[model samples]
Target chain A: MGKDGEVDFSIIGLENEIEQIQSNIDDLENGKGGSIAIIAEQFAGKTTLINKVCSMNKNRVEMISLSSVVKDEKKLQEIEEQKQIKIIDNCHFLYRHKIGGFDIIERFLKTVTSPENKQYITTWNIHSWNFLENTHEISKYFPVQIKLQGLTQEQARQLILSEYEEGEIQFIEDPTENKEKMINFVIDNTIFLNKEIGIPHLKINYRQIKSKLSRKKIILTPEENIFENIYSISKGNPGISKAIWEQSLVYPQIKPGDIKEPCQDMELDNDESFILSILVSMQNASRSDIIEIAGDEIDIERALQVLSKKNIISSEREHYTIKPEILKCATNFLRRSRLV
Target chain B: MTMVGEESGSLSGMPSIDTGTLLSVISLLIIAYVVTRVISFLLTAFSEKVGKYRIKIKMLLPILKFSIYGYTVYYIMAKLLEVSAQELILFGGLLGAAIGFGLKDLFADLIGGIIIVFEKPYQIGDKIRVGDQYGEVNDIGIRATTITTPDDNYVSIPNYVIFTQSVSSANIGNSEMMVVTDIFLEHGSDMKIARKLLKEAVVTSRFVYMSEKHPITILTKDFPFYIRLRAKAYTRDLRYEFNFESDVSSRAWKELKKKGIKPPGANLIDSSSMPDQRDR
Candidate 1:
């Protein structure tokens, strides 16, 4: 919201999604469509759509954003019943990845199914949603599951431009234009102590990955090309696209090639991969919470250091989180190892 | 041979190889060697990268190697050396005689290799037991199949052993493998809680892989002195089979002990008081 209490943000491609959610919310009075589970990849803007829906239906919707790992259902139950439709953001925190981790989420899910006059709209991390889908059948609790799709190029452009004033930023084109190669040999410093896994080997970036990942050597580019590259890399992920724009922009001037793909090494060991998956599922975790869940078998310190050094994760004091820019890549890479 | 074509250094009517022809044969041998080595390296590297399809990709190596070697042999006889009908008959006679005599086992191994290639009872990356040697199939070579046992010992069993022995494959060609973990509890321990904890431990394991089609199963059986709580769960990858078992067992036991579930004393694990069953 603005200083005068006007709407500060606009829903771009999310209009239809927001409408579907609102329609589901409207159907709650007649007891139809059940609650909604807004599932999406990291930085795909699940919270934004929830907020937009809440803003539209202010009187009827109540919102609670879980800021950290939720180990108990008391916090959820303590919230006073006010609105017909309750929105819980970051509900992924309801479950930990331990033997008894599903208890809290299980009880919450039961409550979602129990007799009630209201519907609940919850947002969850897609990874956590997948794990729970296998373990707890979490989707059963929320009949209306909206797996949010990424934004289109035009939508991404508008959403990003909405943050800046007209003529405030420069999109400069370079006079020098060089052709790009379909294949490039990039060096990724692999951190393996064995020294025989061939860490320093040349990594061949094929045409597809090359097109998605910008060149290591950034050349000056035009405005539209820059956004195209950003969209290609972010895959229309609004948060990532916006982050790329912000990183690329230098004060008032920006170039097409300024958005550098953070080529992070994801060749992690079993412990490291497990820790990374925990972080991905939980979104963020306190250091002690991570250690406790990881168990004594895993060297949490070594794994965290490796992840931090690889730029795959960031640590602040007692908390660790996956770096947003590399989230998609890390997720895809870990999926190969069945880590996420 | 000396009585037939001794002066010309020929086997009856068969011509002796010239320097150029020998050089071409040597070059072909080099090419075949290099091709197989390069293909093996590429396949192994590609398998590791395409993690989900590692076994599927590895299953191609033996067939590819066989085809390449078969083609090389065919080309050498038909095009390079250009053997005649009579020469082929003579060669066949010599090979038959050799096989009938000292080379019978080698010939049988060759045929066994062929059978293994065409009819794959097991392939590379599969955990299988041939005779008494059981482990993951590390490499399927022409003469032998190599397996790395659970104890980390590399055991090589001849290809012919597959024919003589009963072979069992744990996971045919799938990445997910079932690992059965057993924990022996005292007769009076809480079975319900133990089973629940075991199931939870297996499902929540970092290495666990569960789906609707491939679900985790827990079973209980009564022993004379102890109750065995068994968990049958699938590890995400077969490579982590042992790790999965150890992880689940440790987690389950930790929870079980905390809940005051006791393990069978003296008679089960103790060497001196171990239970014996000789009843038919």
Candidate 2:
């Protein structure tokens, strides 16, 4: 699709969404300036799509990432003064985790929607957008709303595989016979022992079992179509599919089955779960931001440790984010617990 | 007459009863009671496990209990006593007369329960205030509705009371509930700052439900001594109504105090200057 290890942005799906945005931009160029909201779930390619749209009309559009300018009213005003089509990313940050959190969003909306010769395109997290719509009637202000759908199987495969070179890695598929052998070995090895000498003994060496399992590697070729498995597992989310693909790779070879299905049964206490729910709701947050949202009573560091041990989230520098594949699971967990 | 005697006397077109049939009827009643209790316990446990969808799980309890009890009554009459539909109708008339004379209240309660299950004025887990008792409905029984009050007291109000008293349900069936909190301040307090601070408290509260349909509103009323500020908002869940109110009120008070707003002062009476009896 492009040079090796580079994602061919053009071939990625969402042509319809891009076309609609382009038409809106065209309308803006003809003096019909209005607001449009690009709404999607976390890592559903909202940023990538906006980047592509802006790149296509680099000279005509001004890109403003909201997360960078959310607290800077002067920067916002400066961007507002420029008489050109503007694209804003992460507009949901305007809704903070505190009281009067919607004030910034309200002010931004007022400034953008004032009868003027300007058009603005904004992106938002689906949860935040829903909350704003429910509380502030945000949809009325954004007359044009574009929701990005999950990638199709073909799209997911193309997007994910585009990041890897041809013949660079080998795929591994577990054969039915080998799977049975592993299952039998695990079951036979799991034995409950009773001590007669008045001494407690740990019979199961978990590390040994883990090492044995890790050592048993089987490799296959690319013809196995394991991309379909990744796509299905990620529910055709391009970001998630790509993350799973990357995580599954072990240098020159990869095992599709080795990738854990993102924290489905991890037992989290109430505090840990609450912190996780906040993280999922906010998509990404800093430690201080989480502490503020969770309140002083909660031992946030402990909760973070628990979540990290459970592999529910990952931290990069100052920001912590849930893996794309786990985002849907975490959201469902929050919904089931009625935290949302 | 005894049930067994009545079965034997059916040939002579007269009712009679015997010890064996009486024992059978008693055993059947006990079995029905025990079975219903067991089913109820299992359902309750299941509903607790499925917390968020507990309401949907609870909807099955009334239906199941009705079916089980109805079948048990039928089984006792038709299978145990070996009575025909015609005999049931005749017996039902006599029983109706007895109920009309002595069990009117109990019968009304049962009928009221059936209506409640069908009409759904309120359901299990709904936050309802019946007369002076306000609480979440814990159980809906054939004779009474049990409510677990905020203070954790289980009150069993008769089902028939629904016919006479008004029941206020905070949440009809949805999880989200509107919570109203009131804050009082000195009459001369700044309205702008008070309103802004109270609104911020609500939107920032962990329990508050922020949605367009349930936008937080702070309305003020001028009283002689103080200004009554009522914050109308929604909580994410009905269970957090009190917590949400407490959070908003405490936060608002803190902010108001930080902004130099004070509550109404006590009224002072000048007793020293009052006319003495000797002077009069």
Candidate 3:
């Protein structure tokens, strides 16, 4: 997958979303320009989809990624002057982590609305989108909202299989028994009627011991399809599924058990877990950024080292991110613990 | 009530409590108390280790302690006393009568605790106000609920208070809580500018919960001497409620000052009014 260099920009499960965006662009071309928001979870192909739309209308649309723009009114004004359908990616970056950070979004909204001929196609993280939609009624500014759902089983299978030659990667069923057995007991009572007293007699009787066993089995497809296992683990998120597939590769054969979900069996200290959660929420963070968010009380360097050693987080050019295969797990851990 | 002798052939209905059994029961009670204390301490430590899940982990304490006590009493009654189910039921009824009459308040508190656990009026780590005592609930025991005030004062209110007075919970069971911060500006101040600044202050606060569901709201109330700008926003966590309030207030005041909006003069109102001005 890495050697492919460039990914084919065709969206798999988001064909309907792409069509809606194209229709909106068509409206912009007709001088009936309006705003549309493409919302999805982090790394759910929001940027990819936006790029695809931008490429489809290459000559007519002005594609601007928010990450590339300085968060200033002048930059927004410059973009506003461009007399074309605008595609804005990573609009959530306009939201500041500190107080009064919403000014950029406010200014951007004003600029977008002031121009009757201007139409904006924006992308946002679902969390940030929800926050904006709640605080400022951001959806009201965008007439059209298209949410990108995760890839389907078939779509994930096709995407993952595309990386390998036909029959090159064998899907082997996991031979290990993963089911857990638990014994439980239930108590019951019986009642008898006494004809002489014309009343019902309640007797507490002890029943013979009976074993009630419960077994949990891991279901696998009868046909050798490794993508189903990957989809289940990653919840059909293309990025996460791809990461799991890459991690599970054993050359010619891939076993379902080979893909070890990151941090599943690892124990993390409170500080390490909290730092991990921050990474998951922010996607990628530097040591200083994590220390800033965690305050001086936390030993962020130590926590980073510990997490890195556990392979839950990987350091790249001084920035730390949760391993992609376990992105869902990390997020789930934070949510289950109510840390984010 | 007839007393049944410990001897198998005794005709007395009252169960006999021998000295050995008494000593064993006492030992068991002491053991149960120690175990409960140890478990509570361990669970509390574990809760801290879990970070944001502390409240959920601590919630298990009451259930664990209850089970332990229940089992200990059952052992004393059934195993130690060799009491039948029918006799145990009768003894329970008699004990209930005694408790209802002689220890009514204690029993009421116990029932209140059970209700609090099941009905969940407030939970551990919830920022709640009962009567005038407002703080984060630290522990919900059978007798009383313990709350740690902002000043770190530990106040224990009897659980029965739940039945007599209204209990106000800021966040219910959620970690995020709405914090309403009020900023007063001199009369005739630019209401629009002040409102915008206050809203920005809340949204920008480090402690604020910047989510659509917890949107910041700015409202204006006019009085003779001042215009009250109220900013209602939520803190990301209940623990940050006061921090959120202070952060928004300080930021809003700074921005208001920068915008040349002044607060009402202290001399315009009575000194007594000035003393209670920051009550909210």
Candidate 4:
């Protein structure tokens, strides 16, 4: 739904770091303030990941998006008076507003931390490596700094293939000549950008490229071995490989599948149907918003948890997007079986 | 001298009897008693018609009874002694002083009773604290007051205590008053989640009134090594204060379990024993 190589359920190489992030969140909640700066770059999934963590807590945590109140002092004071956990998003405005606006927030934090009152949870967004360098003064108060990085190629491939849940991706021998070029393109430009593009997006792009190569009937040398060689160059950068593969899919070598009629007669069980319907209807939503739309239903939470464990749907931010292959499977299941 | 002695002897021989005068004195006393009885009856009837104040009736009955007796004694003594006015006046003065000294405490108590009735430092059915004892005032009398404490102990204290000691009167005449309860949880607990659940637990309780604008607050106090979470709210009735307290605490505990939160296991010290010497 976003970039071509987004990671699915697995965080992959950042396993240790993810554990640290979990603990850091726990520490922040416990009112042990030791960190000063949080540096997250663009498309780094900072907001999404934080939201996911926040959801784990059902009632104890009150996540407030600070971007909504960056301008109004009165409203912010009211929120501070309520004394709940506050998550401030879109903090790029700190640079935009010239930091003076944050003075009120600083005052609130000082009062909250003082002996007279209770400590509160506060989260603010800071982008780029320079966030730590620029906010040297502000960072003195915030003791933790977490840097967000993108997914690796293996992680991306796991995400894409796992989208189908029961099956793995099979790279058949490419009989077409263009497979060499597509594979080479993936190896050269894609894996190098693993930090940017996630894994699932890469496979979707590769799938499209494979379709194009088959249509042209060009002679491709060592077709099945292409993925291995491409992976060698791509390394683990799912984003780049996905991007290159996506571009390769548009070449004349490919033949497009005939569009089937939309499945209108599908009748899925509430949990399955609702999950699939929500996926089909919204197309894309942040992880937070999905939890919210689930409303008061415990079943929805269970469904999401099951789906996440099964790697059918992956989340970024508040939006839970369907993996391209999962979407296709769901579509095929609905069209053929009419079971939503 | 011989003639005077004979005359005195003759007078003494007559036994000092004054028949007509004695007869008139007896008649007068009989008449006076009748008059007193008639007047008392009318007064009693008038009082009954006017008001039903038991103290007023009690006061009037003693005065009337004494007046009737006094009149009879004065008339009989005057006829028998044939004393001078100056002698009677001197005797009356001495008698008054003796009575006054003997009844001084009784008089003070009576005045204190009057003060309580009119001044109304507290009224019946008022929850009050006199000196160190706290209770609801069930009866207020001229000489003493009756109060029922929370433990259902009924105590009778002299009325003068109201004038002498400081009194804490809550809803002195009204029935509605604020009741507060504090709950403490352990440190390292999920304060945010714990607080929310506790607040919901307090406000959602059936005993809690919903009209209040401010919501129930869960205050977190961080001591040297532990955190204390206190839940405070108002209740509808003072009598239900304990019920409200226990209900809120129990509900909060259950909610904590449902939310998968464990409160700090450390024992909580009741803060009531600590007095705030400083101004609040």
TM-score of chain B of each: 0.91, 0.83, 0.85, 0.55
Cα lDDT, all candidates:
0.81, 0.75, 0.72, 0.49
Candidate rank order under TM-score = 1, 2, 3, 4
Q: For candidate 2, what is the DockQ?
A: 0.30
Candidate 2: stretches off by over 4 Å: A1-11, A66-69, A74-83, A115-118, A166-173, A177-229, A250-256, A263-274, A297-299, A337-340, B1-31, B49-52, B85-90, B93-101, B210-215, B266-280
True contacts kept of 2: 0.52
Every model: iRMSD: 1.4, 3.1, 4.5, 27.5
TM-score each candidate. Answer: 0.90, 0.80, 0.73, 0.30
Query: Comparing only chain A of model 3 with the true chain A, what is the TM-score?
Result: 0.74
Candidate 4 residues B1-280, lDDT tens each?
Answer: 1121123535654323355656766777788767767765676565433221322443344345445656677756664545457657866788678658785555466566666656666655557888778887755544567789889999987766755788777654543344555555556777877776676666544345333242455677776545656765655444455667877777677667776776545454444533331211
User: lDDT at A222 for candidate 4?
Assistant: 36
Q: lDDT tens digits, residues B1-280, model 2?
A: 3364344556675766667878888988899889988998998887765546777777777767777788988887777777877877988899899898998899999998988888889988789989989999888898999999999999999999999999888888767788878877887789998898898788667677765466777788776567778888888778788888988888788778988998776562233632331220
Which residue runs of candidate 4 sit more than 4 Å off their true CA positions?
A1-340, B1-109, B210-218, B260-280
- Candidate 1 matches the true fold with a TM-score of 0.90
Clashes by residue pair, model 1: none
Best by DockQ: 1
Question: If both were scored by DockQ, which would come out higher, candidate 1 or candidate 2?
Answer: 1
Docking class of 2: acceptable
> Chain B alone, model 4: TM-score?
0.55
Off by over 4 Å in 3: A1-10, A27-33, A74-84, A170-229, A248-257, A264-323, A333-340, B1-15, B27-121, B160-167, B184-193, B210-213, B222-227, B250-271, B274-280
